[model samples]
Target: MADGLARVREQIAAASARVGRTPEDVRLIAACKTFDADTVREAIGCEQMVFGENYVQEAKVKWPDLKDEYPHTELHLIGPLQTNKAREAVALFDAIHSLDRHSLAKALSRQCENQERHPVMFVQVNTGEERQKSGVLPGEADDFIAACRNLYGLNVAGLMCIPPAGQPPEQHFDLLAKIAARNGLSELSMGMSSDYATAVAYGATNVRVGSAIFGNRFYPPAGQ
Candidate 1:
């Protein structure tokens, strides 16, 4: 874990340098999906304070006690979020990167109002329009982002995307950067264990990296 964390830090610096951006310009979220609390503690030992999780249930099982123990840590929900779990998600996450639809926006708004927990959000964009993915298609991204901000009253921090696998991610990253530019958003939550360097080169402000930092997730849902 220490070696993996070191490598990612080095890579992040190198990637940022390639684009003439400082490493401080990019925030690293240690995607800890399927990783145990002990591993997370190990990451904290390595000075990783931000983390991303795929499931609310799993975060619930892990973060409550962990957060109490490590009060400075921040958690981001980087996977599909169910509308029914909005309140639970509100209570658990410090940030959410899956605001892809109007229904979710509505549910989250109501929950934020009720709970007064305004977790910063990113409207996930499906740059490749993959049916199996959970993000707004590129064409609808603008309208969805507008509604999420103007109507639903959610805090639209930026955009997020999972570019097509085995394909060059530069175009998709560019699309996301353009969308963020149009929306006047400063954050771009893209990239992962693979291709994050390209993501950084394309101006990603927050990169969600899991396997590269935490080693491989041995259970279901595998990587983040």
Candidate 2:
């Protein structure tokens, strides 16, 4: 685990430097979704304090205790968010990288009102316009972001995206960067383990990585 983290960090630095950008420009969010608290503790020992989780329930079980032990550690939600989970998400994550809809923006706003904290938000965009994905279509992102800002009054930070499988990811990254700039947004959550180096070369403020850091996710045998 230690070696894995050190390697990833070094690679991130190299990737950033390839484009004359400092490694400090890109924030690595170790995607530790199915891993246990012990896995995260190992990462913390490695001084990798930021992580991304896919499920709200899974994160709830692990992060609070980990945060209590390492208060500086930060967690992000990198999965599709249901409006119903807004409050729980607001309480658990420091930032959310999947704010994809007006309905969710409204839900998060209400939750923010009650909690008095607004988690940083990244409007997820389905750059390829894939039918099966969770993000807003590229055509609608501008209006959606505007609504998230003016109507919901949520802290709309930037944009996030997942390029279609087997496609060149550079264009997707470029498109997201342009959209973010047009909105005067600063953050870009647009990469995963496979293409994080490419993402850094572009303009990704955050990368959600998992397998490269912790190896493959192991699941129980069927019917366990």
Top TM-score prediction, candidate number:
2
Residues 48-155, candidate 2: write the lDDT tens digits.
Answer: 989999999999888888989999998899999999999899999999999988888999999999999989999999999988999999899999999999999999
Cα TM-score per model = 0.96, 0.97
Question: Pick by lDDT: which candidate is best?
Answer: 1
Q: Per-model C-alpha lDDT, please?
A: 0.93, 0.92
RMSD list, candidates in order:
2.4, 0.9
lDDT of 1 by residue, 1-224 (tens): 88998898899999999879999999999999988999899999989999999999999999999999999999999999999999999999999999988889999999999998899999999999999999999999889988988899999899999998888999999999998999899999999999888899999999999988877778656464
By summed lDDT, which 10 consecutive residues of candidate 2 come out lowest?
A: 1-10
> Could you tell me which residue pairs clash in candidate 2?
none
lDDT of 1 at 158: 95
